[model samples]
Target: MASTPIIATLLKGMAMGAADVVPGVSGGTIAFITGIYERLLAALKSFTPAALLVLKREGWRPFWAYVDATFLCALFGGILLSIATLAHGIEFALAEYPLQVWGFFSGLILASTIYIGRQLHWRALVVLVAFCVGALAAIWLGSVKPVNIPINTLTIFAAGAIAICAMILPGISGSFLLLIMGVYPVIIAAVTEFNLKLLLTFMGGCVVGLLLFSHLLHWFLQRYRQPTLAFLCGVLAGSLSIVWPWKHAVVTVVDRHGETVPLVQRNLMPWDYESITGVSSAWPGVLTLFVVAVVMVFALEYGARRLQLKRAANAA
Candidate 1:
């Protein structure tokens, strides 16, 4: 409720916004590492029909209390601000330095897998199988080519629903989901161009999907922590296929903006990337950035742990 706490929440939301923009990274991962994941789920779960009834019966203040509106507003305000400000910068980086950008994301995800996997009370056989299944599904999904669908209200709405669901799930990237659905570019364009009508439609779908999926995920996590974590670890492991630094596009398509982009790509070694793309590959730079990403995740985890300890000590 204090300005200081609100500012901290806003910063966390900004971090989540930055992660969500990248293809292989999930905002949910940020939420987890920042120590807000469970609280966020609990807040989302508060948005029940009973809450709405309370809103009608007791007015704005009671409704806000029922839903933790202050926290949600601050968090989402930060997310939207980050997205609006960072969209072009992220897009430019991805275009101008694809290898480095992806390398960083790859490192972040790899670290995330380790971080989340550690939280599981591992049943060796079950965890392994869950990890494998998640990885295989992500790999298969990565290999699937994007389809060219006619952009209409319904299509945009559906894309938002699906993408938002993925976005909130740890190890699953919502932007990657959009890319797979062939709507990433459209959505990016909408954001950059300030296309309010298209943005609103997509947001409506996102709201619906997020509300429903958050509740389901909350239940799943509460009831099946180990299995859920295992599956998420697997998802992160499998998603590596999508963020490999060196890749050659196996299939390409022209988007609505008449720009050529990769539809399907085959992973390549650094030397092979140089040979194929005729670009310097810059292996040193890529590796350095990748390491930086990994270190950053660990630093975040350490900070969050310290904060938790401090809170506990103060309460005691």
Candidate 2:
């Protein structure tokens, strides 16, 4: 079977990693937009007990072939490398230019919502209901207050499982889910400090969650693509609240390092933010960035389509 170039897959994975680091933007959206979503899901779904049996019976080469190991390894290596290299830079940007960062992500997700919604041909009431439910659920989840939880092995494992599942779902972010669960800081600390034990535990949970959830999601997409897409669109719609550029932290807590962090925040209008914080609203800059993000998505889509057409012509 023809396969995507390793460099291309690695770049896609890096893009996904960059998205996954943000609160509102989803790696799944990047995977979808980059035309790797189905292929990634299919690769993940290849990991079954039966495949393990083949590993034992047919040896390493056949097992690797069955699992598409080369693609998975290249992609996942890129993801890990991205996280390791970009995490601190992303953290700095979010701290220094929160509004711009949020604006960019909001715009990206808005474009994704439109893109995904356009693919759905369903006009059924049930699909609409699913969309509404997904939106409402995300809105509520976004509003929930973060609770302080002890950083332990079991908690890390559980956080990994939940966060990983969200990470792969369109419009849901693993890092955001971690923030919601109160483990974001701990996980970030682990990554920055090179805490191997904690990292390994979290990764184990991620592997388990990714394998299981990918199968379920793959099946759903295959059987009910329209409704599934509608639901994802709704999720992206609802997540906008979480990424709103202007907000005031209503409740905050001092962390282990004595840095103040928001535990709960309330969305604010641009004018209201200026009124409360006595800072420039920078509305024009935000709007410009948002428009740029939207245009970037469309440009990426156009390029991907052209590439596909070129490939088809060559194959013919």
lDDT, candidates in the order shown? 0.86, 0.87
Model 1 residue 164 distance off true place after TM-score fit, in angstroms: 0.2
Q: Which stretches of candidate 1 lie above 4 Å from their native place?
A: 1-4
Report the C-alpha lDDT of model 1 over 62-109, residue by residue, as the tens digit.
898778788888888888898899999999999899889988888888
Q: Which stretches of candidate 2 lie over 4 Å from their true place?
A: none
Model 2: per-residue Cα lDDT over 259-306, one tens digit each: 898888999999999999899878888899999989988898899899
Q: What is the lDDT of candidate 2?
A: 0.87
